[model samples]
Target: MKPFLSIITATFNNEKTLEETINSILNQKYTDFEYIIVDGKSTDNTTAIIKKYEPIFKQKNISFKWISEIDTGIYNAWNKGLKIATGNWISFLGSDDVYLDNALDKYVKKIIEEKNADFVYSKVKLINNNKEVIYIVSDTWKWNQFKRYMKIAHVGAFHNRKYFDTYGIFDESYKISGDYELLLRAKSCLKTTFINEFTAEMKDGGVSNKNVFKAFKEVKKAKINTAGISTIVAFFDFYFSLFKYYLSTFVKKLIK
Candidate 1:
């Protein structure tokens, strides 16, 4: 039997992009999935938008849930969604992001064919606010290679629910970089599969990029706090990541 995927999306006052995100999931060619949306009590029309799509979700017989209550943060909302998810696999889709055409179909088929895989991931194309292509971050890491570089895009990865049981949910202590820490822990335990295909399109102006310096500092602090690495070692890693970020941005400009 094919596995059921629970795609969780968390939103807060995302009226500008909520409908498009919902449409992306609703139009998926793959059928064996549940769509869960956890909203942080948006004071905007986000709830209204979700309600409007309720009939479409029912028509498709898609298991759907939407909660609009105040929460701690994005990761907390994610935890709530995960608790209620009944799918064999789970993937988080940001409210400002969308899957590529037939992304679900391809992912589901790949995982079913490769039954030994514990998690699957693919490339991602970043798009600016104008809908222009920014750059494509390809899947370049296998299991061992992953430790050296953080190549897994959270939005592009589908993980088995069992992995969560073994490892754990996103670390709530981190306001940022919790996803990175979770992946590091998950990869340390599970057997991952890379699809070598573009699974999703991410919108520009993500929180990480919006406040690059602050995000970088938080990530470094989170890594040290969670991983318990030596302060000097963490400093090196922090500077190294900063250097790599600059180099990557330069390379991106050169390619453009």
Candidate 2:
């Protein structure tokens, strides 16, 4: 049987781009997947948008489940989706992100071809606020060097659901780097694969890029906890990342 994927999306007041995200999932060539959307009581047109698409999804016999309620944070909302998701494998999409055509079909093909990989990931195309392509980074990553940085993008990544019980859920306390923390914590236990094509297109202004210092702090803590590093070492990594983050952000602003 083809693998069933649970594509989870967490949204909050993202009326402008939610439509694109939802449409990307709905238009997938590979349809053996369920979409689990956890909304944080969006006080905008987000709920209306989801409601409008409900009948369409139902007509197609798609498993589309969503809930809008109060959540502590994005990762908390993600945990809710994870708890209710029933797919054999899972992937996440941001409210402002989109999957390229044939992303899931390629993912399924990868699964069939590479039987041992616990998770698979692909390349990502980053776009600025005006929808201009910024740069595409190589998705090829080594888990051993993860303590240096997150070489993978979440939107382009798929996870095997069976490992959730083994590694635990996203840390609700983490504001920006929860996914990184989860991946790092789960790295030693899971076998991962890197696909060769671009899977997702992402808008540049995610939480981590905007709040570099806070992200740095959370990532440092997560690295220390998961990698068994000394606080002193994590501290050095944090400051080094801090400098690089600010320098990159500054260069981008100058170019803009």
Candidate 3:
């Protein structure tokens, strides 16, 4: 009797926020999903937090799985989780992110209704480091727009098990844009559905935000390799995005 959904979190030294993430999962109104945590041998109290909640998950009869080890990066850790996920659909939630109480319920209902959809996504509330609301971010999946940039928020997005079986898992070479690369591999054939609801709260300052230039570079490469876009096109997209990122950062600093 496998679950319908599998939620995974790939974390490294995220002790400060991992507890809140776990609590959010525990509080999900829909409880049929399995949970998987992949730890990059965290040197902090992350494992301790996971252990503390192990019994609680068991008490609730929820399937809980975890692993801690040396890994190349976040993508590699996620690949590990993908190997063992037993659900029909899978999603990755950041260790510093939390789901809205009714998030899973909404996602499940939408998934059941959209039987042909292979990828499902919704908006995510972006919160700053202080846990203050910044904005909500997401978009309708348009192949043309996604070709230019990653338009949809991957946070809390559901990926059907068939997607992995058909297109394969995340490419470990990409440190930042692996998720984008994975989606790009499907090209125009990927079926997607969007729920006009905020499903999760994403805390700011993740690796992608902190390493903007490198992430953009990886995104360019992903576009070229997975989407078959011209290198020149990818090059311009990278520089344009880099400029925008710096401009936004500068503006934020000025406001502060």
Number of the top-ranking candidate, with lDDT as the measure: 3
Q: Residue 211 of candidate 1: its Cα lDDT?
A: 60
Better of 1 and 2 by TM-score: 2
Off by over 4 Å in 1: 142-145, 206-210, 221-230, 243-256
* Clash totals for all candidate models: 0, 0, 0
True-vs-predicted CA distance for residue 232, candidate 2, Å: 2.6
43-67: candidate 3 lDDT, tens digit per residue: 9999999999999999999999999
lDDT of 2 by residue, 73-167 (tens): 98999999999999878888999999999999999999877666767888889998888888786656676677667777678478877667678
The TM-score measured for candidate 3 stands at 0.96
Off by over 4 Å in 3: 1-3, 206-210
* Candidate with the larger TM-score of 2 and 3: 3
- Model 1 lDDT tens row, 28-124: 8887899999999999999999999999999999988888899898889999999999998899999999988899988988888877766788888
lDDT values for all models:
0.81, 0.85, 0.90
> What value does the lDDT take at residue 74 in candidate 1?
82
Query: For every model shown, what is its TM-score relative to the native structure?
Result: 0.88, 0.94, 0.96
Question: Where does the lowest 10-residue lDDT sum fall in candidate 3?
Answer: 204-213
List of clashing residue pairs for candidate 1: none
Models, CA RMSD each:
2.9, 1.7, 1.7
Better of 1 and 3 by TM-score: 3
